[model samples]
Target: MLSLRVPLAVALLALGRARVVAQTTVKTVDLGYATYQTDASIVDGVTSFLGIRFAAPPTGDQRFRAPQPPATIYGIQNATVQPDECMQSAVGNATTPFRLSKRTAFVQNEDCLFINVHVPADLDLTSNASLPVIAWIHGGGYAGGSNGQNPAQTLVSNSNNTVISVQMQYRLGPFGFLAGETVAKDGVLNAGLLDQQFALQWVQDHISKFGGDPSQVTIYGESAGAGSVLQHIVAHGGNTQPPLFRAAMMDSPFLPFQYEYNDPMNEVIFANLSQMVGCPISNASLDCLRSVNASELNQMGQVIALDNLFGVFTFVPVVDGDLIVERPTVTLRKNQTNSDVTLIMTNSHEGDVFVDAAALVATNSTLAEYVANLFPRMNDSSIQQAVALYSNLTDVSAPTVPEQAAFVMGDSIFVCPAFYTLDAFPADSNWKGEFAIPPGTHGSELAYLFADAVPGLTFNNSAFISSFQSGFFSTAIALNPNTHGADDLKPDWPTFKQTGKTMLFNETTTGEPEVMTIPTSDALLERCAFWLSLSDVNAQ
Candidate 1:
């Protein structure tokens, strides 16, 4: 991590936390274990309960391992006081407004596996109708982030039908993605995914208490969360073995989970453990690490010299073979999906916010410095090509560079991965692809979907935008997986073809879909296609 001492940044004292689902009126339910009451009057007429912990704290010996299932209390406990978030540093510098609650999410703790549920107040959870369930996993590159995201009161209120929207928090950073002989030999690659799987299992067992139909579950998420969704779908074969969710929607998902970013050069992931207890790599001792104090782990994470390396959560998801099987595309293509998992994969205009030149754009490179940057990453040639292409794209002043390169950055990392994922699926297979050009970046859809998109449009044209989203998604999900209904989410829209007919999600063109003509729209991208090809070829 950092030089063993954590630096304390200017910690802003903030309060006025957004109320979870505006105060509302709805009958509460007692699971005998806990009493979860509903707060209606949320912005979108939905009722929600905040801070529901799904599992016991993974402290002490349970450190750096799969989450243990939560125990049910003997009596009704007040389901309030949202669980403190998992250990994750906040991205205050992010162009998007994802908050700086705890620059490193001080809310984090060993006891961090929890789920927050929101539902339309209009429909009671105890009601008999089969309302759809949307289980969302938060995104922080498998490193940091919480279940209490932009919030889903709006979606629950506006959908006009009952929906159980649950957002969850999981272990992050070294705690979540730490991979080595100790972790691998113990049979866990992405222990974070293990937390997600258990959350789904929690839903199947307890959602009904909140009036959620486990059979009508739809797992959806953006960025890393979306990647986790796809991973779950392909990991255990559509959850059919036990059957957690029936459908899935992945938005700008991390389609392929890679490993180069975690080991050796970034050896800091487990440095604290080594300094305090765990034997070094030569020893492969996890038991030593397991006995270390949890607070010490938290302190170690905060001090980690990530900016020195590259941003927060350095120990991101890796191809460790246990939690993750293979690159997302490879796994799906090889082991056909047996369950009807409705697919809605998407991307945005600017997904890779940090792709800016000031960050890692290579220029006037020393060969050693260059090699050090992309060390051990398969082909050495592709590193230079990536640097050259990145340098060129960053040079927006050049007329030769198309304006669309802004979106292309996201495409290569986020959107392009989804494209590769869809292409891997059999043609004529159920799938939908769309892109949102709203004035925003990564997780920009959060405000539109959960919080407010355009502040001025509140109470006026809000219905139109809300209806558009509901119409589009309802239609796509129903038809894509043939999910027991013939209803369309919106008007005439074209299903994505091998040629990549992308649906445009904008102010004027909500449902009307169109094609992104790469031949003309992306002619300049050729400058980097060669590099990309080499990168892939070199990987193979």
Candidate 2:
């Protein structure tokens, strides 16, 4: 009988024990909401807290509005199983990447505003552990993605229980970013961003219960998530009233084109979505939109997103005066970003996923056609010049039109904009940015950070590269992202302002880590300069 007793935690869970013992329960100060333990106790001493509510379910009349604090629940509730991801359309077919396909099944319903917290089991919340926190936002082009898709278990383990991590799901696609005058007057613009903001508020109020320091919170994101972090830095004219997080880290922070409030194109897309769902245009248009089924709204959103070829998203954040005051580029130029933020921004073959994954080009004609469609302002002469630049830079070993196009796309959409934005920071501000090597495609770094790297996959790298990349994050959490941590951690990674230096994270083999210093090169800075010199053209 003694030998038959399983692990104590498992036995208790199997026996349906629900008691709120001090060792087994985590409590939130929100009206005494208690969360029960899980059997996910790994050998590394990490504890997983899955599916904790950060906001009230955005359903019924609450739909399309700013998030509200979650309703208080009494007694110990089970937080063992992952919660439903916010509603999203099924993605990628047989040809789609496995990384994306694995995430589709977890998406469930509208009431998906949930947060997952990962803490070391030995952490004593009652003591002054005051662990640094990393609030991660996942990347999915703002149209699709869920917190359930990326677990923080590996990240916590990799950090050696040195830090606490949090990831939360906000509204996606139409539900998160359907901006029009009709919706704006009735509610807020950029509800998805607001969802993130509210989650941070929740963290500020409750992270201490898990041994995390609210004041030491650092917001980090990749791709669209990185874009969201940049937005927070520039939100409300960069005020960050009440102070959400102290520092930020953005990986591949892509700023897609956004229209200045109520651009006719924005209204056109909103009207199209409304008609698709039989939401008649009227004074009560927002109400009509609310009445439609969640699945119907998501289905229509996917259709519009699929129809587009260029980077034009069917649903994305816009320059509403309230939440986002102006174009991010414009804000950056004016030095309107929050100065309080010490930032680390980076990109990995930023355009590889955008161009290579799409199978976008096969010949010169196709490449030219793609460029013209993406940047309509460029005439035949300008397009020809751009083509010449990319053609000359194509890798000799793997020379292909598509691969060449990927290089071009990387510069245009990812690399160039970073330099342009960094220029916006004051010369004294502590900011650093870099480019990763060994074919750092979009969303590639995530594979290493999450320990989800798959062999034979395009983004997979040497183990040394993975461990080295992971250090940037752990160091950031232990110290500040701007320091990037440790004088001897890697060589000396300098800040962007100091000597205009950017450290490159590269490795020669699976066992050898190489740290090299290189200036920020957009590959085609001259070309980017030319494009930037142009006045706003109706690229549409």
Candidate 3:
């Protein structure tokens, strides 16, 4: 017979096991077709489920086509490792910022349509734990960047376990946005945008399993990602029934020249890409491109993009007549948008990263020359009008040619599009802000939000981080930045229509976070109005 002492010892070991479960236990979620398991250890009270496939790999014949639903998997899939990034075009040079180029080391592959989800470790999956959700789309000029670039563990933990975060990957560069009459006839245009929409639909279907409320999703993004938010806002002529998202937050939306699908320049870009990859331009060009090796094709895309103007992206979203409908400016002006609320932010200097100082100085380019290069479709008269509008500005931030170029590029591509979005929504439903930390250039605010994720950056201003996160997470959680329980350090923010005021997030001269509100600048609005008037000419 077994001794009483041995039985008592076994019982004691079982009683102490619960204390160590959080550190060693792996979490799993079932979604009918597949079961994904999260990381074993919980960090900062957040558990991450990474690299879950949302769509099937776009390869072979599927290349350049819209993303299709992922095939069913028989066994539990490991979601602990970050997914490989979609093939990216090399867009960095000596003058490129370190923040943008740091991702050169990320592994890339064609099978990269995965999504990552982060939720509180203590969330009860069996119970009715319908927490808020924030879906992030990263910015890489539509050419580079991965879903892993912005980790949401800190964001989920900072929300006091009240919100879940999701990030997705989409095809980039030529594979996603290749356009022309040939592509329109054979493949989908703006395939990357379709990938994003497919991921959002996936979120609607699967987020509830992760303890998130599908109806309370907030879409947030930066640069091209933010521009994507604008695209979705105007998607389907703003008639997305049973809407995918209720709110949106755009950080430095990059609205470059969106050419029509069959425009001469786009056709030329397609022909050049095909020729570079040995496909040549013909009826079978699409099939030839599909047959080429992935690396060879991606390298050709980079070559073609770098061969073009210095600071322009070659394969951005175009007016596809279906998903895109028309220029975003036209759609927004008609008050046709899907999102119910908007929070838009711009950096103090958005153009610095895009413009090369040596190129501006070496060419001795005039404003008209720079503007012409940026928008090749604009006629000579319109170029001169743009030059005239910006040439003699008393409020020019700096007098140097580089500064002038930055101002012009920033306004046309980044800043002014923000104003268009702001003016599109009802004042009560919209809010705007400027991230003005000294020399507040493009992507600088990202460090403040994801300090640990961004490399080679150190932010010690706890107060500012607290204030900024409160406003952003508050908006995602409650649809208002000034919601109760948000950081008290932040001032009473006002809607854009209520006061026409822009909240400025800055640091005092002594290096402490300072939050204040100021009326929208009349001078800036004047310049934006001039740019908007030329939308038809610039293909905006």
Candidate 4:
């Protein structure tokens, strides 16, 4: 027998520009257990349903466990207000430039596993509108960030009401990424990744209720979010039956040192975390840690993460023997990826923000020292090879040792992952791009995509925004970037497989948009190949 819990006196008010006065009645969707009322007043043509709970609160005994579906709700829950972001942590005050402080300024809590949906206002819910869906996963090095950072209103409006955009919030910091033999045995390893997987499954089950086509789902993310996309691609050795997503878009996918579940470093981190929380490291540590307060555990995780040398996060995804069978490099090399179509891009200077400028200038750290610090497991032979490759770099972009260090960091972590992803997928089914706008620092291209939503971004080039959004929307709607809208002035983007060509997004000296395709530099490819070869030693 089927039991449905319907809300009583459901009244959804759609507001006009003022948002204070009711303009019309809004629609509601019944998700078997609960009914949600959406807000159609935030954007002009987009209706947003925010803070829809997908999983039960992961607090107390549920901490460190895989996400479970939400409990039954009895009434019409108001989903207009954004939920509290997942708890966040930073290394002192150095993260201001990356906007971590601003993004995480809101209230945070353990009951933070929520999903937001934005759809075209006029889409018919009764009819089979079946709009293509874009599910976004936020990035904060897998430690910090909220789904509210990048709003999907613009993307939905730009799609001409042809697409639906969904954003998901998952666990972060120690709550989401804690891993060791004890955690593996008692709690789930990669709980954060499992949260993402569960959210995608929620979309599969409920997106159609809002007129989305489950078959045309595209998973899009940037930075750590993009890395999460890659994790999903290689999940279960790319053998996930009925793949979660059909297409994927990765912007500057971050590939950090993916240590094994029971690596010495992870064991040390777990021990440190348990000790900090007053829990002895033993068979009962998992339960003991779970008994500790959420705030205390979060603070301890931040302390442990900051204890490491600058430029890296302590808690990140690990190579669990099950979900992540092996290093992503190994999976990608063997062509074991699940997604069918992929669009990948990277900034020209991905590592600038990650390198410690003060330490580089004061200590004059050698390129070898920088490399070793970032990848301690790397062997002497590989370190020498890396130093030989980057030390004498004469390129004007990376002339100094610090610049060279930044280049090594960028290539190994961001650029090479994009190249490897392109190589792993079918050439004809994948496309590549480079965001070379002035400075081209990591997350710079984000402004072009979410200019109105992201704070402190000064990008206002109308032509570039249209071109960039067109390319992204076309891929989501038609699975091809070249099929841009008529207003888009960008040229036809060629596939990476066809000519090894990359669509470079830049501006002319006079600040006009200069978007064109060029052959991917063989020199860069050579450097990435060298890095990929040392994946084993680097633990990537």
Candidate 5:
């Protein structure tokens, strides 16, 4: 999930009002309950219907429960503005990464279950031919993110009217992922994930109305959102067929062991939050939590900040043994993943977003404290072993203690687990991973893909990457199904099974992307072996 606000330098560029003219054509789409007025992206040849509700508000008695679809609409509903973001703590400049001159308007509310749709105007609107769809799930550690942050308008426009895109909003923070014995007995863990599944069901049922192919939907997300895609693949023991999505792309999936509600560590998080909000520690605690003010609950959630070593999110999706029936790796190894084709991508400096010089200095001075933070369950001997294995003096690639720690954290939580996830697929399945070289921070690629989001911003691949990304999306989703293998000009992206080969997205001095292939490294293999040995390390 993106925590970086559009910098103040580009605030003026983002403030331009959309010019609506009387002569412009007005398009309307009717779902069973509501009719929507589609807004045209004048410069991009795209029409969009924003703020379409996919599920009923998780409000009132419905709070903390699985989402239900909104009831029928009484009349034509205007869908100009998308819904407010799901509830989250304010991201004050003090906590934000960038130093901005202006504060972003941080608006959030409970009635936030909605979806935004964008369609290419050049598609054959008169015929019944439905266009392929890309359903984008935003990531903010599953604790704080909104679909409103990166609108699909730029992505659709960049695809040259050949693709249709959808962005959705769901419950966030404690409201979405609080788990414990009381909470689990009465309600579900990972309601936010269930919310996403329901949204996909909505797309399957209603996307055809807006010229989108229900059978051709591709689910894609970044960060925690990418984990959501992976979860869906292994959902329900991975036996279910005719998946909601035909394919998937995971951008930096963060896979930690999903905990059972009864685990001591998991219970403590819930129990502490319940007590902080004045809830009784009995079976009634879940009910007591329901009665608390939504704002108060959101505020209390801030007490749980990013853990030092593992970057554990306090309230996150857990292993409930139902929706997420087994460990992701377990189900994945059993060949339970749903998508026919999968793509996983990550950058070289993912740790740059979360780890810094301050963290490094702190680790260097207090190595034991750092070890305890990352491995609370370990014994003195085990902690010492861990510190030794992760120590910079022992590892030359990252010669400093801080850099070594960052490398271990990133590889353990993200990079290696991604490798494990790919290798877990059936030997015959189609899957690939890409490593974006330096300058490609966490979600920095978005600036190139959706330059419209932050006006005046640019990247080396800004001129051609959009087309390349769109072509890749087309090949994956079958938007131009016939042209995939036949397109000679496109890069021959090899499958991982063949040679353990990975496509390197390198940023060169010249303003262009240089794609190369390199055999998967032995160092990554060795690092992943170490991390996988501690797969159940109780990260959060």
Candidate 6:
């Protein structure tokens, strides 16, 4: 007899069992996931639970296959503590100055297919009601990141309606990606995307028990996360929002696979990087590589080619026509999506963080050296223009040469991606385009959205709080996007028509949402437009 056992206190509160006791603060709970269940402690500030398994391990025979659903359990699983972070390459080591934030950047492992959930402290798991939920996907070029990286306690606490913040982990690198032939038979080769879809399904089936309004969910992310969120909409025939999420926020979204797929430039990157980490695929010795330890594979993240040769990134989610229906750009241009859900398109400075001199100094010492660091076969004259444009964007009072490089990084990567995504929107879309200003870098808006990181980073609370609330309101709009959150601050922002509507987020001055083809700060899109028209020009 498999008699399931639940905690005495929790059992009393279960549907079948009943007990009454003092209402004490609970910092943790058990979420008995299939396979093996464990206790994950909650956080002090809010109702938080760590190490909630979202999917079964994608290891052993399960490698590269679409993730299997977590098994069901009759007993309660203790979710009182968070598991370690997911397996990933260490970007900046603990000693690195940029890695000094209080956040824990370590504690990773291969069996990291779990997610963390944080909600308001007063959340009543015993209630028969449901609250709106938000799922967060972290961005790391799809190479490094975990559910533990971002906490949703603040967002959930701030939300007027009940909200749940979830951060889930997916496989990375050769194990998660490594697209070729065998994998495509399953579908459009992007297995990582499938991992995400599965997690959303888990949310739909199980979130109600956790006090989440399954029908009012919102999928949100930044950078690669933004790309994942967008992929859900235009891919497969199903919508992640209709049944899964009613709203979505795509920030600094990028489509790396659309830009390049198995090109010589990136092959060199892979080959060279593999060599640096002692895994070069010489003499068809990939068999040994396949059996290599997962930890070793992650350590190789250090060798990833930094060469921006063809102005492309490697190992991103692809539009395999299976997982992702079509390229995000094409879908937006065609407006072949559910316009019922409101979409928020956001971007930031192209250069600030990437151009950080510390990274340059860490990687190389001189400008000429950095240029040479770029892949050797580089013939794109755009490289010269890219460098010049970066320098021109900065002021003579710039702190250092590297400080100016941030602008170049911003323009080439983030700014362009944001511009391309918004511009691709047809007059047929319910999409509204907005860009963060001034010192906006990749994760800067996080400072505003998260209160703890705000004052420390010199972020304006007043402007940010309103903006954050506006985001919540806009998420509501995703269900019916045209609905305004605060008419005083944002009076029904208009969707674009080859022209973007700008809504500046400033703390000191009163600003209003306005319409335009582009912000005054935006560089015209004439050239990038014509070039992008030839997106499929060369297959490499």
Which candidate should be chosen as best, given TM-score against the real structure? Answer: 4
Which 10 residues in a row give candidate 5 its minimum summed lDDT? Answer: 7-16
lDDT of 4 by residue, 1-540 (tens): 002322332232221011231222476888997898864435667777767899998888899999998999997876666667788865433322332333334677888999988877776677867889999988888888876677666678766777899999889988999989999988988999999999999999999999998999999999999999999999999888777888999999989889899999899999999998899898544789888888888888887776666668778899999889999989998987888889998998998888877667778677888888778877888889888888766443576778898888899999999999888888788999898887898999887887565543555778788887777788888889988767777789898987899998888888788889988877788889998887887778
**Per-model CA lDDT versus the true structure:** 0.54, 0.66, 0.81, 0.81, 0.67, 0.53
Candidate 4 residue spans exceeding 4 A from truth: 1-25, 91-104, 394-396, 456-459
Candidate 5's residue-wise lDDT over 1-540, tens digit each? 122322111211112233341112455777877776654443357766666889988887788899997888776665554456788632222222443232135556778888988877555444676877889988877777776666566667766666688988878888898887777777777899999999999899988888888988888888888888888888888754557987777778877557776678678877778888998787644678888898888777765533213355666778888888767777766766777777777767665555554644744544555556555676777667656666733323566665666665577667776777677665444445454545556676565556556442445445345434643465455623124334322355556666687766665676566666667776667767766666566431
Give the top-scoring candidate (lDDT). Answer: 4
lDDT score for candidate 2 against the true structure: 0.66
Report the C-alpha displacement of residue 349, candidate 1, in angstroms.
3.2
217 in model 3: Cα distance from truth in Å? Answer: 0.6
Global lDDT of model 6:
0.53
- Model 3, 353-391: lDDT tens digits are 778877678768777877777776778887887777677
Error of 3 at 225 (Å): 0.7
What would the TM-score be for candidate 3 when compared with the true structure?
A: 0.92
lDDT of 3 at 213: 96
Better of 5 and 6 by lDDT: 5
How high is the lDDT of residue 325 in model 2?
82
Q: What is residue 530's positional error in candidate 2, in angstroms?
A: 3.8
Lowest-scoring 10 consecutive residues by lDDT in candidate 1?
1-10
List where candidate 2 sits over 4 angstroms from the true fold. 1-39, 89-104, 310-312, 339-348, 356-366, 376-385, 394-400, 426-437, 452-471, 474-489, 509-511, 534-540
CA RMSD of each candidate after superposition: 7.3, 6.0, 7.4, 4.4, 5.2, 7.3
Q: Cα miss at 26, model 5 (Å)?
A: 2.0
| Residue 465 CA displacement from its true place in model 4, Å | 1.1
